[model samples]
Target chain A: MGNIPSGINTPEILVDVEKLERNIARVAQRVSSQGLKLRPHAKTHKMLEVADRQLTAGAAGLTVATVGEALNFALHGVPKLFIAYPLWINESQAERILELMKRAKLSIGTDSVAAVQQMAKMLGEKAPKVKLMIEIDSGHHRSGVAPAQAVEIADAARDAGLRVHGVFTFPGHSYAPNAIDEAVNQEHKALAEAACLLRKAGHQVKRISGGSTPTAELSDNSVLTEVRPGVYVFGDAQQFELGRTGWNDIALSVASTVISRHEGSADIPRRIVVDAGSKVLGSDRPAWASGYGRVMECPEASITALSEHHATIDWPEERELPGYGEQLRIIPNHVCVAVNLVDSVLAIHPDGAVERWDVNARGLNY
Target chain B: MGNIPSGINTPEILVDVEKLERNIARVAQRVSSQGLKLRPHAKTHKMLEVADRQLTAGAAGLTVATVGEALNFALHGVPKLFIAYPLWINESQAERILELMKRAKLSIGTDSVAAVQQMAKMLGEKAPKVKLMIEIDSGHHRSGVAPAQAVEIADAARDAGLRVHGVFTFPGHSYAPNAIDEAVNQEHKALAEAACLLRKAGHQVKRISGGSTPTAELSDNSVLTEVRPGVYVFGDAQQFELGRTGWNDIALSVASTVISRHEGSADIPRRIVVDAGSKVLGSDRPAWASGYGRVMECPEASITALSEHHATIDWPEERELPGYGEQLRIIPNHVCVAVNLVDSVLAIHPDGAVERWDVNARGLNY
Candidate 1:
């Protein structure tokens, strides 16, 4: 990565365009080789530039987690968009989705009969091309229904005059250590079973979408037609630590200045404090993760704790601590959360020009 | 504790103005009773309306984390502001701060001679009544120098033509369970020692500031001239779980919709999924925190995991799960981080009128 501009402020998100494009291209190629369509999840970057790059790199469509995000991308003229979340649509949101449907080919996810009925009730007879994918559990157990239960949601949607566009599952369990193989296996099985049940129920099981960044490489195309991996575009510390990506593949980082450095005392260990804390880096440290985040410049350094405006890096006494005012790039454990925290990100190009990309879909949680 | 407006969307921040005023007044009265000046940290709410409420409640000044935040408040006509962070000021930041000094009485925290020298050099001879407070490490061990080292920093600042106003420390250790008394005690001792050292070296330590929300009520006025409690204005899950504040005292909460609900199968446990996740309610789950956040309606339930837009609640099967589209209030583990995630908050008044309060200093993380 190129050096951050001295004119730019510290504790800012810096996206390396070269690595970003390479990461997107590599994933596109891998998905193509596996005979699967890539519907890259736009929830990761939430930037129009990143979404445009992914679409230009041969992504079939963009997957989002909210109607607001879908509308944001749709308004930006993304032809096809998928809200890959089981949304509990209110009347206003339903109206917004209906309006969005006129601009883009939109498909939302539903795991329950109640949500399907609510959408149907909100839209009534004026509903236009309402399409939904039945969400399957796939061992995540957070959202989505059981493999057999997908048929019930599909039946409800079909009865409610909404088109059932096959099934989808999020292998959220893949985020953990050594669970990728099992998560991928469960994902495949759940999608296959759900698709079979839907087909048996006389529904056209056209798309079986399933994939997380961790299990994207091992995804099987036999039962799945499209994969929706979000974090592949910007490799995070989680991906790197999980052996999914290399140091060179990390595209997005927080450019932070070391504000404080301390030598070991009897009560405290030697540490360097950076301005990028939970507000910038986010506080998404999984149980298995090494620390709050990983320092790209000093891999051995562990960010032991995070205050709102400070990240305490536990430096090895052997290595010299970074000097005060020295800028260091940090890879957040989860890049999506980090990206959501900022208004815009600084994108550094290979030609040494840095541009700011607005996170247009930021904070569109609804 | 009023019903959320139907027009407002889900996963949005809702501030109870009544509780907010009460929280501010209660803390103000307590600090006043102890004869300590209240300089509530603006980092928690970052809203002008909330800051105004605290100021009206007799806050001496506002405390901020960065120069950008300080400038935001200063521009909003807050007369006195303290950047309660050990900032590594660059030339540009120094220039901004220099411009800021013209409008407000500003004091910044410093922990090292290098930072003091950098600030002094950057401010040049045109520096306007520069006030520097030596930060002492009062057992948090994140930033701040040792008690004896405070004199060194104060000496450097004094030698550099900067006024050493006093010393301050963040009793961050108080956030944990049963750590309040010890943290307050240590805070008192650290400030006392640092003030004594600075006094012995011929520096007039006028304002010895200390106090976090957990230790604010237990603060010793004998050593501290001012208590800077940020989170007391908006009680969070941390404060509520730690017994620092009652449930009725929580002012800010995320209004979320129950998007999906699932009964336990053989492999999965029963859970209710809400739209408000880590993006709305930040992912700061301290080791001692019960979960990601707390549900006001269902205190018995635990938010087991959070996705970017989904919070999985481990709802007890004994009670019927909330229906789809039902709105519930969630108290985030860290109110400051949660407040920073949104552009504006909906402040519900006592008479049922809801007003939008723009988070003016939302992303002003320098």
Candidate 2:
């Protein structure tokens, strides 16, 4: 796997080794200079190697979305993990969570009093109690209780004998370009208000966590102790659209081959079909995305549409079309989902050697 | 692993062993009765065990969407694998294809003359003499040459010394209700016309294949020698919405736990958040789909929207709401993409025994 050449593989994920290292170094340096904890979210690159790079670069901990993700990272010896999503604790899953806790310091998020009570019942007589973070709905009307109702849930969690660690919120609205500043400000206010309420209720509120990739840039570290920005480690289309990262900073691309071609008549420009399709690049065209995906070398050529095994592209008439059977590289709109869509990524080393790394956590969605 | 109880585990994916076996048996019987080869597309299950079951049940061959899928199936000793995608063959990939042909009977689809010529150049003396299938566009407006133009490509494939096996098309439009009849009819017409054109050109057409799960039941098998249907084994929300299959026929579901319960307001109607998000279930909401996803047991409930790590459901106030930490099963809109998003599936046996089968081809999209 390590001896293979990077450009030879078809429908393979290509991670620009240099760009990835630079992105990790930049994020780690920024967070460290601010005297804040950097818990890079594993939801973006659910790979142990990426997590190892972050930890080696001085990340305080790792942030994961599922108990399975936490377990994967913990098995690889990542000491501190935060299951950032509000977890549903059942009798069966509780046993898995307990096992994860035995390996690493675990903190889980919850937004309901019933969930806290359920966890308490499941964790009855356990040596170390699971740390709980109350999720507050800052601006994103998705999961999480309202900031005004945060105290009630915190009180309930504390009463259930679960250690109420702090309040956390995801400013998901920040993903939108115009909403970043507003979302971050709202997150600051929501976390501050929730912490004040929890403190007034006699609960020790230590950590105030909030920040997604879009919001992390503008987030006020003065209020929050930690930031979890997953996509920052591998800038994607969303980052490019939001102006969070430049086009050259994108580290991942899908290497595909031109399978079909229809030369331009007087009416239609040259149309080339690439083998990379929804299954390879992932059919994630956000409403705001320009196209299905963008071409790395030929940025002007947009991936107009995607079928199960075909990416339709309209090449400009002035530029010579890539001959059929020619290999082309594509930079996906959303790298996180694209990475999840492939089994392994071709890691191009600085010395021009290619190593294939199995996305060990590729499909551990459960 | 088979000794464990299925219900005790979390509800991400539930395998009804009886229903799965019944599905395989029913499809096999139908194909056998029609005197057509049954090459079940492994894209739906992506599991080696399921592929083995289909083959053991007397499947003639296996169908896959990518070279990686073909390689994975070939590794499991599933000989005679057809890569149903019109692959873009480059020099580097041609070598790999030649390598793959050594282990299995490799057949690939092509819609362009340039690709065929490229394969001819790369294959050289040790070309493995791959079988080529011409793809015809039957109103899907996706890949494949038009029905009228497929013969030209077929002649090119033959001229290049490749075996022109058959013509194939995907009736992707059959995914909507009242669309299957028209789509399948178009498929029949397209394949017939393509076959006739090839025969007129003094070429032997051994097969005429086309059938997706949506139109598999209604497909006209008189003109076709074989039919490929992937999702019939695991009916999903799309099948239910299109009226292709009833809810009772659905054999796969995502098991999720109610992690958050919004219990404060009567107007809210007890909203519960599950861990299944777009990443897990896939953000596939077809225009005809009822919602993002459907609750497996509570068919009336709808998954209104999905965040990265949360599924927001609006529960009915008339009935008792699912308690926090209560487990619920969800059927995704598209099962093929959903199954590919996970690493392994828990196979629940008839007597309630659970066995985990690695989705050996889960993300082998390359």
Q: Score the docking of each candidate (DockQ).
A: 0.81, 0.47
Global lDDT scores for all candidate models? 0.90, 0.79
TM-score, candidate number 2:
0.91
TM-score of chain A of 1: 0.98
Docking level of model 1:
high
Candidate 2 lDDT over residue span B1-366, tens digit each: 123243354535667777788888888887778778888899889898889889998988999988778888888898899888777666667767877888999788888887677777878765436888888878765567776787788778777777788889888877787888889888998899889888998878898888778766665468888889998887888888888767877788877777776653643435667777767677777756777789876888778777656788877666577876677888888888778777777778877767778878876666
Clash pairs of candidate 1? none
lDDT of 2 by residue, A115-193 (tens): 7777788778662366788998886767888777888888787677778888899988777758778888899999998
Q: Write the per-residue lDDT of candidate 1 for residues A136-240, one digit (tens) a residue.
A: 888888889888888888787878888888789999988888988888889998888888888888889888999779988787588799999999899999999
lDDT of 1 by residue, B302-339 (tens): 99998889999999878898988898998899999999
Worst ten-residue run, lDDT, model 2 chain A? A1-10
Candidate 2 chain B least-lDDT 10 residues: B1-10
lDDT, candidate 1, residue B295? Answer: 91
Model 2: residues >4 Å from true position, as ranges?
A1-7, A32-35, A125-129, A264-270, A316-318, B1-11, B31-35, B56-58, B90-92, B125-129, B263-270
**Best model number under lDDT:** 1
Error of 2 at B346 (Å): 2.2
lDDT of 2: 0.79
